[model samples]
Target: MATLGFIGSGNIGTNIARLAVAAGIDVVLSNSRGPETLAATVAELGERARAATPEEAARAGDWVVVSIPLAAYEQLPVAALAGKVVLDTINYYPYRDGRVEALDTGKSTTSELVQEHLAGAKLVKAFNNISDFHIPSLARPAGAADRTALPIAGDDPRASADAADLISRLGFDTVDAGPLTESWRFEPDTDPYAMPYSAEPDAMRAFWAAAGEAIRSGTAPQTPPHVDQGVPLTAARLRTLLADTPRKLTADRLVA
Candidate 1:
């Protein structure tokens, strides 16, 4: 069993950590606030989890999840995560993250910027599209008739596989949404980016198609996926909404 390190142990980080532990993975948790702040979470996760510094967590994991706010990407410990599988669960909201002209102008997606910072880390974009509140409760057994699917995008095949494997253990299916450059498809405005997984797959595809168009047209307004806390999505409802839209391969060059 590989060790999973989390760089931001907030709502999403802690939820995923709990799920990972339940799935039999060891987790090392960190945050901008330091190890002491995660005492309760560490206590809850028991022997399977340990709290550590961000750099320490980065160095300790076979797989690392970076769940910090997009604005703080520059703060990630690039050198410590080299050659590691890094799951990027970041989404940009101008109001919360302030303004980054490059991202706003479609010059670069947030993951790309993180990749640039941690050039040696194998980066995968996932978990960002789902709500923190629902992550822990939604995982089901692999191939369970009712398992929901989550979208993942990354530049590295092996790293993506590793991420998908981790996702599977958490009780959901994985959709390879292409390379990190196409991660914009799951950005703030896109249908799949934040929509409740409870929706049927067709509705999900339709929502993403509609949302993707909104992004291409420069009209996304930081709207999140519709969610009502505590309500779990049905498996059939999640599958019915899956679609087969053409995968996008965006220009590799980040906007200057």
Candidate 2:
């Protein structure tokens, strides 16, 4: 079984690790605080999971998940992650990450910045769009009638495909949203961000398209009301709501 290494074992990372463990995949978890701090999490994950330093986790994982804040991207072990398939689940929050001029100006997306730093690693953008609370609840078995779909963007086809496969193993299908540059479409404020989709593939695609239309037409809700509620969204219903709603980007909004 391939080991899934985590560079930051926070909420999303920990949840992913849980899913990986349940799927029979071994996991090596790490965080900035240190391996010692992850004792509880490691114990909870049982024999299949162990704690390690960031560099050790990076070097050990066949597929590494970099789930740290955008502000901490530079601190990642670049040399240790060389040639690894990396899944990036970072989102830029101005208040949390401080104001990044490039991100504020739309010059670069968070994942793009992460990709630049991890040049040797094949980076795929995913797990950022969904709420951490919904991850575990939303996952469903493959081909199940209600399996949710998540979007992924990456420059490398092989790497993206590998990410999609891993996501499937975690109980969600993947919708290819093109390369990293186009990843902004699914970023914090775009149509697909945090919007729950149906288990049916076509329904999921329609939800994405409708969300895109709402965003393009300046009609999507500025902040998703259903985020905390975990609304069960369908393509047709989401389309109507998105069209009727209106979005307003604040001055502090993270661009690109």
Candidate 3:
């Protein structure tokens, strides 16, 4: 019933747009390359989808998803996104994003930086941990046995709740992982980063904890494990994993 606008229509953006359309949400897609480059994606999403400039998409969306590289956060249209609910799906990779002193020094998290740029917008961090390739298969209708859960972090309670509802409509439950500062828990290489989980919350939690332990100990399984991609997990498991996970210094995390 709502229109979802995307500032970056790459792998994660396009896949999320597909899910939004499947949920009966219209989508306006945009990218730095120009609206023309999004023709195929808009067509694939059918009548409910259209292509537009980043600013246009920002103005058109009920909720705007900013999935662009972390380095490009400053380029987002600030005025157009004013007072909008923004879903931030950015991750920092020094090699890819070059060096961002704020991120490198742990002065602020990635979502915090985006929030600073779009000062009037309500920013929520989510969908960054999962791989685009696993999204479709991992989704399940509400109450389905195989439904999965995703984590979201934000400073605004209302905005966070709205984001959780949207995530549910997209076929996954939401776990409030505190404020944006805590988002690093689900960032790259963390326990809950890209690990798949079961429809059951408990199972999903367990999977997160196990995965976290494995990663810290250097025993995490390679992608495409013997089993299928979406692994089952529980909340209790995730808590345990988070407890066991050692907090790395910002300097150490930035090295790679």
Candidate 4:
């Protein structure tokens, strides 16, 4: 009877909640907009989920996931999350999050900034690389040969192991990508970003082409499609993709 809490009930947050509940974990979801706004989502998740204020969600979790915009990191409830293992599914997008000087000069990885703001929390960078649409579609039963392995990076080994276990229970394997500093490897525009788990390169490209256009034109759909279960990525393959690759930043990484 474990409970997972969320600080943002947007794309990534809801998807992870769905997976967690499906795995028998209860979820407490909150957003910047407030709990009442999440009524429909709570109903959709059934009895295993409920909506609360951000502070309540922060304090309620056995382990919490913070999937908010990176710009809002410092706004998180620091006291509530002080000693918790916080999973960060946040990435830096200049256009969406504005410019961050430390990131601009390569002095900080996104999670490091999050960790610094949360102080005593054990933070792990995770669930950030994959597209939210592909999340549920890609999840497979444990021990399934084709189960995809997501990458996680943390400064603490024990916390990383706990996070890895969380990912496994939600139906994915995990590959350790060293410390938080190395998290940049799987960010947007990198080899392992969201493309590999997309199942088919063409479908991923087509959906993004249409979706990105819609977003830019101010009409993006609420749910992304073409992901009827992506390719099952193995640990070996993911390891190869995680090799010593340099970061590649571009405006194309803007994912709103």
lDDT of 1 by residue, 1-256 (tens): 6799999998888888888898889999999998999898899899999999999999999999999988899999989999999999988765456677778677888889889999999999988878676686667787676566778889999999989998888777887777887787766545564465544544444654665556555787344466434334443443333342232223221211
Write down the TM-score of every candidate. 0.80, 0.80, 0.84, 0.91
**lDDT, ranked from best to worst:** 4, 3, 2, 1
lDDT of each: 0.77, 0.79, 0.80, 0.87
Residue-level lDDT of model 4, residues 224-255, one tens digit each, is 55355677778888889999556764433545
Per-model root-mean-square deviation over C-alphas: 6.9, 8.1, 6.2, 2.2
Which is superior by lDDT, 3 or 4? Answer: 4
At residue 108, candidate 1 shows an lDDT of 85
Per-residue lDDT tens digits of candidate 2, residues 165-240?
A: 9989987777777788767666666666665432343444455456545655668624332334244443354344
TM accuracy, model 4 = 0.91
User: Model 4 off-target regions past 4 Å?
Assistant: 206-225, 249-256
In order of listing, the candidates' clash counts read: 13, 1, 13, 1
